[model samples]
Target: MKAGWTSKPLEDACTFINGLWKGDKDPLKTVGVIRNTNFTKDGALDDTDIAFIEVEVKKFDKRKLFAGDIILEKSGGGPKQAVGRVVLFDKPEGDYSFSNFTAAIRVKSPDELDAKYLHKFLHWTYLSGVTEGMQSNSTGIRNLDGDKYKAIQVSYPSIGNQRRIVTLLDEAFADIATAKANAEKNLQNAGALFQSQLTTLFNRRAKRATHTTLGQATGGIFTGPFGSLLHKQDYIENGIPLVNPAHISQNGIEPDDRKTVSGETAKRLANYIMRTGDIVIGRRGEMGRCALVTDAEDGWLCGTGSFFIKPSSRCDAGYLVHLLRSDQCKQQLENIAGGAVMPNLSNTDLSNFALELPPVEDQKQIVAEIEEAKESVERLKSIYRQKLTALDDLKKSLLHQAFSGQLTQ
Candidate 1:
């Protein structure tokens, strides 16, 4: 602790009030309500989607949020995120109350502890992963342990020093946030550049290109076995992997061993087995998700949500995979897509998917050029992504220093 600093339980420094429950009742006025969605990952409030709900007058009077109050997430977290995240409410007093999944923390004495100081400290605790231990889970929703959270010992110097620390953090964090935003933008631009190259290349070729359906270009289009033919009971922990739509990412296959079938089942579904040089394309969900089957996944079974295409002497497998994932192809697939809830691609539609096909040799050349462009884009993205990660680490380090009484005056 610093020389003039004092420490005490958070409950002693602030008053905690549970949020309001939007229950079934009559005779109430509608007001904007802050839900967990209003809280951003960076401990900031996102009020754009606030829900306006009717609340009892008495409940609103007791649960309404005020400026400088810290909103704490008491419930609703996922496997990767933890409950107990705190965001400061700097908005002016309004008819706003937090959801039942949250709680309000009001400073008991502004003369001793600054609200921003406490909010920053609590935010630091969350960023440093201190709150991960102060949580429990039930029925898929993570709940913060209120007893353990309020009992947290918050150490701070005098009010003057505390405000100084907050000011330092605010300035430093603002700069860091700006840098992070730039890095993220650069990263996105890198990917966009690659996509733009593909779109331009394909569009240019389409102008003076010979057109043909995928069925005429490829040897055959084989859909996976029906769900009735392959039961969930056939899945095994370690066996032949299934190339489901989820496994197809970034023009590559990422199979899950847990979502695999036994060798016997794979043999029974041998007709759906994808061989080397074959193209596996998703038939359900998001369109344009496809990957070329390599030697690594030569014998993997095509999942029910996907189908495989055999490249004939006419089409280059590499070129076909890239073409299928391009923006033009995605737009075409969307045109002939079925099912409104979950758009699906029928085998007939895929087989009859129209495309401007170049000569096999020219296709290979275009594939080489596109791959080279992709490599350059990936390298640029890597640098920007690393910068973003470093910025995040810097923020975490700053939080650690601030809480440890290491911030300069």
Candidate 2:
């Protein structure tokens, strides 16, 4: 500890005010409400996607926000994100009010405690997992223990030292943010470069090669069993694995043994069973997403949310998978997809889709070339991703030092 420094509970230094939530109302007359969705991943307030609700003017007056007020996300976080994420209000425009999922914290004595410093300390505590530890989960929704959160202690130096610390942190974090942005851009560029290569290869091939409908080139195409035939109740803990759209990733099919059907159920839906060399395309969301079934995934029961393409000897299964994943094919598939609420691809749509057909030998060569390029791009992506992770760790370290008075030394 540093000389003249003291530790005290947060409640002693600040007053906490719970937020409000007005019920549904007409959009024309409703007031804008800032909910947890308004919170950015960087601990800053995001005004985009603000919700609105109708409330009496009298009730609205009490929940109005002001400059320098810190908003704490007291509820509604998931397994990946923890509750108690704090964001400083810089006095955004309009008659802004907060939702019941959040609370506002105002310092009791500004002379003794700086609002910015307190916000940074709380952010530090959140990054340190202190806030996450104080969370309780019920029915999959995580809620912060407000009483315990307010009671948590924080140590600080004198006001002069606090200002200096905050200034140093502000400068350091700004640099860290720039570095993180660059790393993220580079990561994205690596992926884009790989996609560009894939597009160019396919584009050039399309120019010289003969084109044919997907059905003409494939052995057969079929969708999985209808929802009425196979219900969620049919899923068994230990049975035939079911491959859904979620199971198909860019990498390949990721089979979940837990999401399975009994042998009898699988037999009943035998016509929908996928075999080795079959190309599985998602029928619902992310219409372009497709994966090739390897020997390991053969005989898996295809879920209702997918389509199976049994490739003929004329087309390589791996090449077909890569073709469907490309931007060109994705755009075409998306065009024919039905339903505004949930876009989907029907069997007729898949069978009629035009595809460039090169020689079987050429298809193998193209797949090999793309695979090699993908490996290089993935390596670059991994390096940039590691740098991003390191930058986050660096910020956490700086926060720990600033709060513990090590930075002052």
Which model scores highest in lDDT? 1
List per-prediction Cα lDDT, in the order shown: 0.89, 0.86
Models 1 onward score TM values of 0.95, 0.94
Instruction: Please report, as a residue range, the 10-residue window in candidate 1 with the lowest summed lDDT.
Output: 200-209
Q: What digit string (tens of lDDT, one per residue) describes model 2 on residues 1-409? A: 6678888898888888888756444332367788888888778888778786776566567777776778999888897888989998876567777888899898888888888888899998988888888999988889899889989897889888888999999999999999999999999899889889998877666655778989999998989888999887998886888888999998888878789888899889999988988988889988788888888888898888998988798888888888889887888888899667778888998899987788888898899999999999999999999999999999999999998888864
Model 2 lDDT at residue 239: 82
* Deviation of model 2 at 52, angstroms: 5.2
User: What value does the lDDT take at residue 393 in candidate 2?
Assistant: 95
What is the per-residue lDDT of model 1 for residues 98-192, given as tens digits with 9 covering 90 to 100?
98999999999989999999998999899888889988889999999999999999999888888999999999999999998989988888888
Q: In model 2, which range of ten residues has the least summed lDDT?
A: 21-30
Clashes of 1: 0
